[model samples]
Target: MAVEVKYVVVRNGEEKMTFATKKEADAYDKMLDLADSLGEWLQQAPLNLDDEQREGLSFFLAEHKDALGQILRGAAPAEAPKKAAKVKMEKSVATSKEGSTSEKQAA
Candidate 1:
């Protein structure tokens, strides 16, 4: 007699995929979960973003809409698109130590 182990991925009571290892199955499940979360978050994100952030995100999404669709649909592209550069903010603060004042700027 032989024993077999099955790693199954089930969604909505239907078997979606099977893997030989638990790790593979778990990774797939996590990916699906993350996609679902991302979809929900994207739907709600615009309301919370500032005008500049929204515009940047919108442009990025437009540029990568096909890749994003493929990812959300459970397909991986051969190469992921490069991320946009982050905007830098500079903050200036003045501090006084022992009757001496100095200003510091951080970016």
Candidate 2:
């Protein structure tokens, strides 16, 4: 027999998600709370957004809260995308080098 403990986040009597660790579950629940608040804020904005658009945008903002915070604090948003692409390319090159079949060429 095996023993397992899982943390579940439930909202409105529905199980939203389950996690192996309490930290992750708590983080997810907090993000949901942020998203809900953002949704309400969007409703009061002058720009007209449908329900789905507001919900999607709210979640996106919550998920990228750290990056958004940086932008809000005067960080240059344009720089991050190029740096992210470069890092991704570097990672791919490193992975390919590790799987190289021969000294002359990669597998």
Candidate 3:
């Protein structure tokens, strides 16, 4: 049997895309990571953002709210005055762990 190599993009418990080479896959992954970073940074500190940039960022957050939430939620510290926010953060972490487990299983 011949061995085949494929780079896969998995999202929300599903394989969304496949790449023929690892470099291509890495590029796509880096782009996604950059997008997440941009979203988080914009949310945290959006000083002096132009109208078009603000609109694009808003659209990106709206389109990828779930994924962006997971990224930001994980990075955020557990220090909030409201108990509900703290509890929500904990729940998000739990769900994130579960997702990591699923990814490990898939790998």
Candidate 4:
């Protein structure tokens, strides 16, 4: 059987997380799947801030666009960068706070 490894590339560098058979890697892109799912969840059931929501939506779009580009060029879904993660985390936290504030204000 041919052994395969999964590597996530970032601007600064790259990291290898899992080693699987070539078959397994083709069957499912573990890292991208989680990232896409989380990104979708954040977009669908967003917390509050319209701007943050918009930003998240934009991020989602950019991700998909990049994925499409990769597909066209015969590549796998790319790993999200650290900067994108940091921005998303900050937006999520801000959204949660805004959601709570709105709830308290309403009550």
**Which one wins on TM-score?**
2
Off by over 4 Å in 2: 77-107
User: What does the lDDT come to for candidate 4?
Assistant: 0.60
Q: Across residues 68-106, which tens digit of lDDT does each residue of candidate 2 receive?
A: 977996766777777779999999999888777465574
Model 2: worst 10 consecutive residues (lDDT sum): 98-107
Count of clashes in candidate 1: 0
Clashing pairs in 2: none
lDDT of 1 by residue, 2-107 (tens): 9999999998999978999999999777766665554556657647776566555655655466788878866575433322112111111222342243233321
lDDT of 4 by residue, 1-107 (tens): 97655543332354433434555553335444555555666666646647566566655655466676656666555544555678899999999999999999999
Worst 10 residues of 3 by lDDT: 75-84
The digit string of per-residue lDDT tens for model 3 on 20-40 reads 998988766666666656656
**Which model, 2 or 4, shows the larger lDDT?**
2
List ranges where model 3 is wrong by over 4 Å.
Answer: 1-4, 11-14, 45-107
Order of models, best TM-score first: 2, 1, 3, 4
The total of clashing pairs for model 2 equals 0
For each candidate in the order shown, give its overall lDDT on alpha carbons: 0.62, 0.91, 0.71, 0.60
The top-ranked prediction according to lDDT is: 2
Worst 10 residues of 1 by lDDT: 84-93
